[model samples]
Structure formats: C-alpha cells, structure tokens
Target: MRTVRNVHARVIEAPADRVGALLDRIASDDDPLFPAPVWPPMRFDRPLGVGAEGGHGPVRYRVTACTPGRSVRFDFAPPADGHHRLDVEPLGPGRCRLTHTLQERQGPGQALLWSLFVRPVHDTVVEELLDNAEHAATGRTAAPPTTRPPLVRLLHRLGQERPVAVPVPDGARLARTAFDRTDFSDAWRVPLDPGMPRDPRAWRDVLPFPVMASEGDELLLGQDARHLDFRASLLVGERDVTLSTVVRTHNRLGRLYFGAVRHVHPFMTRLVLRRTRRRLALAAPAAGSRHRRREAALG
Candidate 1:
C-alpha cells in the first residue's frame, strides 16, 4: 500500500459561516474543489449521507463505504485491482488534513509497480487537489479589505476546504524592505554552518526560508506567518554538524492557520558537496598509505 498526504492554507476574509457553506458545497466533485475540471471527474452518485456504491470510469471499482466528514473507501478491479481509502481529519482550530492510501491486491507485479511508479503520481494529484481547495476556500483572490472585519471563529472539518494564503503586506514593496533591512549581527550569525561542516557559503538554501548572504558566516532567510521569529544556530558534531532552528507561529491573525514550515539544518547545506568531495578524496590514492600495499598486490 502507498499513502499520500497533502495540506493547503489560505486567508479567508469571510466569516466562518460563509466559509463553511462553501466547504459543504466542495465535498463532492459535482461542486468541485476548484473551478476547473479535474481529470477522471470523480463521478459517483451524489451520496445522500454515506455508504457503499458501485462506480466506473478509467478504473472499475466498488466504493465499499464512506463517512461524510471522515473517509471514503473504494475497491478497484479490471484496469487495476486494488483498494483505496480517502481519509480526512481536523488538524487544529481551522485546519484539516487529508490522507489517501492505495493498496494493490492479488498481484505482486502490480504491487511492485504501485510502490515504484504509480505512488508518486497519486501523491502529486492529491497535493494539487488540496492546494486548489485551499485557494478556493480562502477567498484568496478577493480584493484587499478597506476595513478589517470583526473577528470571527474558524471551522475545522474533514472534506471541507479552508484558506491558506496570508494577507498581502501593506505596501507593494514590503517583502523587499524586510529583506534589505535585516540586521545581520550576533543574532544572525548562528554558530551553525549549513547542513555539513563543508563551506558555510554552500548551505544557505537548506536553512529555513530563502536567505541572503552578506559575507562568510553571515546569512538571512525570509519569515512566514507560522514563524515570524524563525532563527537557527549551528551545532558541531564529531562527524556532521546540525542546524538548530527555532520558529513560533504566534497566530497574529486572531485565527488558526495551516501551512508547512520548511526548515534547514546548517550542516545539511554542505552535505552533498562534502560527501562528494570526501568520496573523491577517498578514491584517490593516499600518499604512502597502508592501503597502497593492497593496491600494489592487486595490480
């Protein structure tokens, strides 16, 4: 069996009730998570509540059962013999999580193919679907509000879409100023070097967010809603050093939000380069080494 997980976030200006109504509409493909048509167009009888059903399309299968705000199960045959279950659950105050599992039955070859090839495609599809749902639920593209609305509670429900986008910053160039004005002081120079103990210059990307390099040990990474105070330091180990990073979401929006918080270890930054260089150094003959005798004997 192969499993995939996806998350989406958006900042919806609307009230919780407004968002909930929209989410209820999105539960089935007839309403759709996104405005556009998706491939295979999940066509099933508009389930009254939830239970078992038979369906057909690119794959023929029996949808064994389903729960409105919980999960859906399908048993596939013909084009593919497998069983799939789509599960949804709440994450936090206003966030939800979706998981899909696919298992091949009766054929080892099909199972191997599923593990190797078919799995990734399913993962990508689920991710895209979730993102589209996030965009739609958040009222993301709505024009900036001239006046902020009174605080409203958020809803977290399975099979329901929620907003994930942060509000646009005040000025058009706000993001740029934050980048330029960052004070690179003792605070910025975390003792950590990027992922490995290689060149400190090489590991900035692996840090937290995208960063700007000022000089040798100096670097800067952008901030996000989850962790506006994101910071990192380096820890040296016997063989490999680790990047110790910290971030706090501090949900200032007065509501819960969902999003991935990417992190980078200082040492991980140079891991690839260090590993490659180490391999090359080892492969080359050492000067007057004990191994030389073995090499000479082999020759």
Candidate 2:
C-alpha cells in the first residue's frame, strides 16, 4: 500500500469570517461553495456537523469533526483509509486563505485508479470549491476558472445517471387512455436534481411530436401514423421524472414496423432522458447566484 497526500489552497479577497461562513454552509440547501450539478453535490445524512453520514456520489464518509466557521474534517468509511478536511485561515483584516487537504492509504489497485481517474476529478472539484468560496465571499473569483480536461469530461459523462425501467404511472392519464387497445407500453424514469425544473411543461421538448394533452403534472405528445399511433408522456413527480410511451397497432404493417423499432427503443429513451437531465442541470443558476437570491429575499 502507498500513502498519498493531496492539497489545494487559494487566497480569497474577502475577510476570513466571510469566507469561513461560506464554508460552514457546505452541503446545505443553499450551499455556495461545493461545485455541483456539473459534479455530484456534497451531501450528508443530516446537516454539516459531526457524525453526518453521507458523501457525494459513491464516496462514503462521515464527518468526524467541525469548528463551525473555521474547519471541518471527514473520515472515509471501510475499504478506504483516509481523511479529507477543509480549513480557513485569516490572512489579514480583509483577506483569507482557504485550503482542502486529502490524504489516503491506497492499495495497488486503488492507487492505479486514483492516479488515472480519481485524482483528476478530485483536483477539479477542490479548485472549483475554492473558486466558489471566492465568488460567494467577494462576488467574483480572482483567478481564471478551472478547465476540465477531455478525459475528465468523458469520465463525467460516463458517470451520468441512467434511466430505469418502471411501470407507467397511473397519473399519466392521457397516455394510459391514448389508445382504445394498447398494443405496447413502457416507461423509464430518471431522478431530478435539486435545481432542475419540476414543471412537466418545461420538458415538452423531449419528444418531436406536438403536445396532445396535459394534466396535473403530465404532458402527452405523439403522432398518429399510417403504421402505428403512439403517445409519449412526460410526468414530473415529486422527486423524479418519468417518460412513458404507448403504441397502438392498426394491422400487420404496424406490428412489423414496431417489431424492428422496439429493439432500439429502450436505448434511445434512456439516452434522451439522460441527455435532457444533464442539459437542464447545466442550465440551472450557479450556486453562488442562487445563494445571493435567497439572501436578498431574506433581507
């Protein structure tokens, strides 16, 4: 096994207290530090304090210590031997230094993965966090923004959430009753991230067909063709969005056409949903702007 220590630090123009306060809100609903939507959001089971038991994406860790506005430390779970921490130090009356340090003991396999993949992503995230801290504390970042490499971007895309097959929702009434005799039906769903739009109307562009009907939180779209009549429903639920498809075959010609299409339908639907989710996530307001909006409202 080999031991690895990685460190990233930046100086922010804002006062130490201001930068530290921004750190204190990490993983909160209004977090203005952690880069998210582009990367996985840092999260904990409860709040940002000792014993909070959650980690971003597949990482599993628990907060071991915290000093409110100054520092926080997290220890990794089993199979991983390490701790990562963030600290804020007062540089002067109107300046502060923020640092993130991660140290881990890795086996050969783990080390290989880290050197090839994890390290690049980790470095990017830490830099982005520092950038966010600078922006939230002073309304702008001092340095040029970090740019993701092609490999990192590819890895990020590969790690994107994929849709899962699910039964058509009962709430999708228009889709459920689209055809007098349903020849085929299927549904797939993907989760909605915190800042994603929840209105089904916002997802109307998921399909090329014109909107046929809408109710509650569902929008139906499709066309009646010579071969088959089909309808697609986009339902935005409390925590997820479901895409459902229903088809009615008029005769042997419809059945023949659909038989060939069904094989690729699953792959196409999943790809479309994943792409749409990522697009919308990237389009959401940045965390710093959102935090400022909330503060403005509160004031």
Question: What would the TM-scores of all predictions be?
Answer: 0.34, 0.91
lDDT of model 1 at position 288: 18
Instruction: Find the candidate with the highest TM-score and give its number.
Output: 2
What is candidate 2's CA lDDT for residue 224?
92
lDDT of 2 by residue, 123-205 (tens): 98888788778777877777887788899888988998889999999988989988889999999998876667888888877
lDDT of 1 by residue, 1-299 (tens): 34333233344343444334433443343333422122223444555234434442244566676565455677775666567665555655666555556666546676676556554445544554444444444533334312211221111011112112222222212222333333221111211111123443344444445553232333335455442444443322232323333344555431232132232332343343234333332233211121233335778
Candidate 1's displacement at residue 113, Å, is: 3.6
Those runs of model 2 whose alpha carbons end farther than 4 Å from true positions after fitting are: 297-299
The whole-model lDDT of each prediction reads 0.39, 0.88
Error of 2 at 24 (Å): 2.7
